[model samples]
Target: MLDIFLMGLLMAQYTYTGYDASAHVAEETKNASTAAPKGIVMSVVISIIGGWILLYSITAAIQDGSEAGLTTLNATATGLPPAQVFLDALNNPTMAKFLLFIVCGAQFFCGMASVTANSRMSYAFSRDDAIPGSKHWKKVNPRTGTPTNSIWLCIVLSSILTVPALFNETAYLAVTSVAVIGLYIAYVAPVLLRRLKGDKFKPGPWHLGRWSAVIGWIAVVWVIFICILFVLPPTLPITISTFNYSPIAVLAVLVLSIVLWYARGKKHFMQHLDKEQLATDEKKLLDEIDD
Candidate 1:
């Protein structure tokens, strides 16, 4: 039982890693073209290995639990054969601290992966003149073939917000949960717009069509459910009191994301001015300033 819970926790962590690899390499590939093929293969390999690792860990945990003469699992591990085992190690201060570091580490990497992926998306969107800061983010470093500045910009911002994790376990989980939801919400746009709306926006040259929509909607719902569950006070509490204000934090993050989307993106929509118009606008601005 302990093993099963441990395994689940470990797998949750492995989930966060592979995505970042693809993002960090975004610029190196033939004008932003290479990561998809490499990313797909990379994901496949890691996912298969990651799954096997979790399976092995759970099997070992079961063996350990049986040796301890535990007919059933303890209260704290995650996967059951033990219903909810998030805190089996809490009784042991050292183990609790270790697990805290592990959870924080995995979630941190997961968030980092998100930062990578998002910067690529933001950079790509900007390249199309569809988002703010498009020119700078999409600019490749002359030598590295990386969106160097954008990568650092995102990493820095993500790290700062991640600071909240130092406060309490609940805060850590809540904010990450919110970030997770934001990821899927951004994904849903391409899905729902194509599938439900049929807005004549065909898939891009390198696009996933009908199937993507199905997967996207399913994933969105799945993630939403998990995000909600994550913030909910655990049905079983490991400590003296359950946590609070998790949903509130989630709301704040959501609001911030929305504000950012509009503050940065609103002007770009349907407002693509040709070079001449832009030059004229710039000249006018300069004249007004001089006046």
Candidate 2:
């Protein structure tokens, strides 16, 4: 039961990673405080409902009683992926290919959206000189009004980071672990910082009110627990093939970031929203007060 729950929790963490997509696009959104949160919630709810339906359909398809379906569903013997099960169950090459193509297209778009969100977030952070190569990454194309450099930066960095998958047998586990753990840590950091600020924390346009502290604490605790669980070896007798490298990868990046910040980043880095021009509401309030 414990093992089953652990794996289930791991999957949940992976699925929830990109729900912050709306937050990344806040700059371009109208009524951002309201809209972004709704976007996040809607995205998650839709994913859950859609995923359950798809899972049911796949499971049903596999029980078609055909010889090929039974063989492919025998995962231990066939060594087939879930998509192969679909192909075998249908027993029609053309239809199976079409269905697989649709799935692949959806996945491609999902990945593209995620990359878009990530690059935008990176661009925003760098605009405040928070990243190591701020000047380069923060550049917005005059014609396109997009952070073209930051987009490529994300693409290049992601490509480089994923190179280990080519050589490692359990690479998917390591990669997914790193993603789940790192994003949760990122999600938790500001919550902890807000907690530290206590009463001095300013209420946003969409503040949580009385439940803020409770929710924040719960998030912090859960994230910490997840991080610890993910870092530990998934199975005993860890070897080169079985070992999880996610914790090591995360720590390496963390250390490198710290070293870079101390060496050069601190001097150029500006506090987020400290630049008056970027504070739209504050600027409006100040103008009204002056008038």
Candidate 3:
């Protein structure tokens, strides 16, 4: 039973890793890939330390000679559901409060870090006019030299997300997992686009050169694999609605909208795709600012 639960936890961690990698890249770190890499490394280090500490504490507790072997659940004593075992703490009030405070601090810090990345992604998508509500999401306040509209949009979206979670925790995880798959698929696009380079493949500072073709092909396949893994049903037997596929469904709608934007209606929507020049200009402006 422990082995099975642990396996599920590891798989869930993979989905979480998938979700975080995007923010680590083009969004949060901007041009500083190394910073994102370092942040990820540090996060892993801290998490492992925390896990080790928890393991040692549990080991000590088990040795204390409790009938259930110091198991927080104490299945025999509590007679409550296994889930509530962890909540049944043995700590003193003062120490328990301190632990709660530390937990809150960690969560708040995570929120701050996540928001920084989310806002940047919103800005980037808006700048390219790809988001549905581009004007607000991509908007930049000249006075502040920042994307104020983008920041507000993020707040609205985050608030909206909390509504669903009020109903169920599994709902939230399933939904978020699905959304992440679509984002991953979008991320793989540029990597695969370099295959023929056709005519408009402008080489950026991060060029992979002769290996660029191979990289794109490899990345596209990897993305597909990740998407499949993420979209799988949470239960042993895979079924369509059993787990979250929201991201793929969302991406499907976006793709349809994009098609109409280009061919059927909303011609202005296609303009964003024609803005390779924006990336070029943005890069130049950044170089000048650095100079």
Number of clashes in every candidate structure?
5, 0, 2
Count of backbone collisions in candidate 3: 2
Candidate 3: give the clashing pairs.
178-247, 179-247
Model 2 whole-model lDDT (C-alpha atoms): 0.81
lDDT on C-alpha atoms for all candidate structures: 0.59, 0.81, 0.59
Best model per TM-score? 2
1 or 3, greater by lDDT: 3
**What would the TM-scores of all predictions be?**
0.57, 0.83, 0.59
Over 4 Å off, model 2: 64-80, 207-210, 271-291
Q: State the lDDT of candidate 3 residue by residue for 1-291, as single tens digits.
A: 654554355334433433344343444355544445455446666667776686566445442356455454455453432223233354455664565567679668766666766777778766666667777777767998667777777778787866776687556665566556655665677556666564476554444568767767887887776676655555665554365555556667688877856663454444755468768877875674454
Residue-wise C-alpha lDDT for candidate 2, range 51-113, written one tens digit per residue: 889877876776545667555566534354566666667888788788888988987887888
Q: Please report, as a residue range, the 10-residue window in candidate 3 with the lowest summed lDDT.
A: 78-87
What TM-score does model 3 achieve against the real structure? 0.59
Backbone clash tally for model 1?
A: 5
Task: Put down candidate 1 lDDT per residue, 1-291, tens digits, no spaces.
Answer: 553553244235435434445544555555334445457557867887976886566455453455444544543344334222323523465664566578679768766666667677666676656655676776878898667777876777777877877776666665555554455455445556666766564343344545676776785676565555555555355553456455676678778768867886666743676789878977775554344
Clashing pairs in 1: 3-61, 76-84, 76-85, 76-86, 77-85
